[model samples]
Target: MSALTETDPTGAGFSPEGLARIAPWMDRLVDEGRLAGLSVTVARRGRVAFARACGQADLARATPFTLDTVTRIYSMTKPLTSVAVMQLYEQGLFQLDDPVSRVLPEFAEMRVAVGGNRAKLETEPARRAITVRDLLTHTAGLTYGFMEATLVDAQYREHGVDYLAREGTLAEMTARVAKLPLLAQPGSAWNYSVATDVLGQFVAALSGRPFADYLREAVIGPLGMIDTDFFVRPELMPRFCATYAYDRARQLRLFDDSVETAFAKPPAIASGGGGLVSTAADYQRFCRMILNRGTLDGTRLLGRKTVELMLSNHLPGDLAAMGTPRFAETSYTGIGFGLGFSVMLDPARAQILGTPGEVAWGGLASTAFWIDPAEDLSVVLMTQLVPSSALPIRRELRVLTYAALAD
Candidate 1:
């Protein structure tokens, strides 16, 4: 089948034949019924090198997937929240090292879970308060309820500490999280958690407005990410894609139908952790700002120095040194956590075809995007599938895309 792709890839150091290599691979997945549909965009030096969408967006409806189709971005929301909060930082609102409790009093005195399970929890006072830096780098002692790995997280599940839940505001949920015991002492380990949700509240507390409002005005609006938001509008429902998950037999099954999805309406909580829906085109604009070093067409969102700090590795070493290496957005070996994105310390160690200093992150629904400063590149993959680990698409695309680079 033919694909809707770029007419020319030469302007951005991409081999036209090399880009041709991507279509058949992408088509094979859809042909094999591995993915319902997917949209990919590869840009270099502020120009589109390659773009394509293959297969059905709504398999049941036989809807054709297009580049503008919107899908849930999930955890990918972290980077935007990080950038928004950092804008406040550039304005001298708060320092990276400042205690988050300085603005939100809920996190003033926190506890760490030292022993026991959800049934019989044990704890000790946090060695220190969770800091803005900790939240940004995920060094904060916070834990996600769904981890199912530790007593702290178990308690999180027991307490119904869910960010996706349609009830309660960000402020109410932040208070709920603060009341729970931390998985580790602040800055002790790297466990992916609801720290970004807390950062959302931190944004509201500092800005004296709602999290959604601040994000829209400061980050999403300024970057011209018009289709990126907490929920899809009624008029845009036709462009929303359905989400999927594998059944016990490893067959594709509808996870969330496109027509009747929570994303169709504005959410109550406005999760900063995993709650935005965006199109491949919209998200690329956001990536373009990062590649442009915190400015897009004279709409400067952050200072150049602040952008530098966001991309730098905040952890002392690689994520593997962070301990035990729990399930995270990226691999542990040579990957490092920057302010928001995962920094590639050494592509060889991570065993991926990526450049050193490249920053990237993915959503829970198998959607991913990476910005490479060294190569002046950004790639976005849009798809709807739960448990992003269900398939090796992210790494596979990494190999395929990097192999297509002419320079």
Candidate 2:
């Protein structure tokens, strides 16, 4: 809805000729029917160097995508939820190493799965309780049912451990998650899991406010991310893009209708993991806050040191060293999981054009964002496709975006 296409990026340290390539690239993607609709915004040194949208928000309606087009950001919500929890950490509400059970009694004592099938599970006492940092780092041994690679993941499916089930509140579902056998011992490994959803419950219990409310007041509101939320309000529905998936024929097909989407209303459980709909404009601001060391427009949601800690690598080594055999939101090579984002350790090792210490993440929908501290850059690239692995757009855009840098 806002006319935000970049008017001039030369002043922002980008070559005009290089920036010119983006429009045709987007046009090619749209014209070839690779994307139904897409929007991208790139900012460096707090100035937008390139911002544009192409394709249709709704193939049926021919709605144009724009900066305000709302998208299901999915796992991108993890960073925001992680930031919210760290706000309490800054208050000394709890130590990062403190057991999660200190706030949610459901995880007080837990068992780890050594081996077994989905029909029966073998377990032993966990080496230690899952700590708050474990949840933040995704080392608490939880597994997403969707991974379907291990018995614990199957158990998650069997017991409905997903936040999408709409069975109860964040607290109620997280308690169920605690009852399940952990895929591994706490701090023993990293697996993409429902750790962030549990972190949502932890925030609610310690802050004495609902997870969604606290997230808004402490993080989203302060950043002025008005259009970023777990649900899209009625007034904003018109700009909400329809989600898509590749059919067996490899053609785009409607996945989630914009008008009938569950995100059109509040969710039963606030999924801090893979929830929240946002626009390129709103998410860019979120990335900018992180790029700006936890402050945006004079609103400080977290201390600078806390953000530094978050952006720093937390794993013992790169993700490939973790030996996690599960489908993840990020590549497990030359990348390390930070508190809330994937820290790029080496561009050469990762085989991607990126700077070390770049914090980034993507969603179930082929949406992605990254904040490169070395380059003073933040970018949000949005499209409505499901299963991000469906395309190599993120990597392609990264090359295009970084190539335009003149300073």
Candidate 3:
């Protein structure tokens, strides 16, 4: 029941007592059987402020984890990809509305899925070619590895579309993806998907560099996010936490050892949407950059205007196109879908109680983080818990964490 505290890196007013509020919940996740290992960090005004780790790196012993322990950040990579694309945006690499075909040309004539037998499927020109903005906003009418039940899914499988493998290049991924039909027309509906992966290819095509190299130089390098990358170096392997999934019996258990060398080096397919590993401390560097409005410390990754554009919700009404809003019970009712994360505008409508303008996103592995510029607060809760089972934990953690700010 003891409180954990750390000094704020900026010597700001952010106090350890703020983090003390969530100490019990973090402990209970281990004590009550919801998680095997986890790390939580809350920083305000450029400082660590609070950090804690509990349970064993593995299930065997309750040995504490370290800041270096890497966790699969799954979709958290979206924000990074968003930043990369936005970096190009700031440089005038491509206007947001430019047709995606302008860069890759592969998706210029893509088809849309109309359901039913593959043999009798209808084919037509995409209402509009996918745009650069579409890729950033998840409205590119694309699908993910887990979506679809027909030829498209089989194509994904046959193409060996492993987002984590260190073999296929971004161009190769685009060619494979282009062959598959889109589930919707560009900018017509929202579907959380492989759009960012396409953006990765976009980065390669426009920058004339590999997606991983572009991200490293354009995003990670400038932000000093050293621990965030496609692969965890061999020396850092011990800190790479084992990923867990719902077992056949519906229990949490370790799955694979970092998805087949993904954490070792840049995979051939750079999944801008979902394929990256990072540590809590490392990811803070990225979040802190966003919270700072495109600048952190002194280095600036985006213009303030561009940051505003990135954080603002881009989805139109008729939310039917996008997949069901995830984690509504977390009080996200007034929240609307943005290009990369969820945007909270009317806390009342979203039935969520956070400050307005609070934006957030989570990875499939239950990793979640958000920045509330209004409150000058940032929260990151990391765990290997399955996405579904961890919902209660995330809601409780957010409510409890925000409640402490009431002080």
lDDT of 2 by residue, 119-201 (tens): 67899999898999899998999989988788888888888788976557788899899999998889888888899999999
Computed on alpha carbons, the lDDT of every model, listed in order, comes to 0.88, 0.88, 0.72
Clashing pairs in model 1, backbone N/Cα/C closer than 3 A: none
- Per-residue lDDT of 207-265 in model 1, one digit per residue for the tens? 99899999999999887787889999888888899999999988899999999888878
**Candidate 3: worst-modelled 10 consecutive residues by lDDT:** 324-333
Q: Write the per-residue lDDT of candidate 3 for residues 228-259, one digit (tens) a residue.
A: 78877787776777666666675667665543
On the 0 to 100 scale, the lDDT of residue 47 in model 3 is 55
The runs of at least 3 residues in candidate 1 whose Cα sits more than 4 Å from the true structure, single-residue gaps closed, are 1-7
Q: Is 1 or 3 the stronger prediction by TM-score?
A: 1
Query: What ordering of candidates by lDDT runs from best to worst?
Result: 1, 2, 3
Off by over 4 Å in 2: 1-7
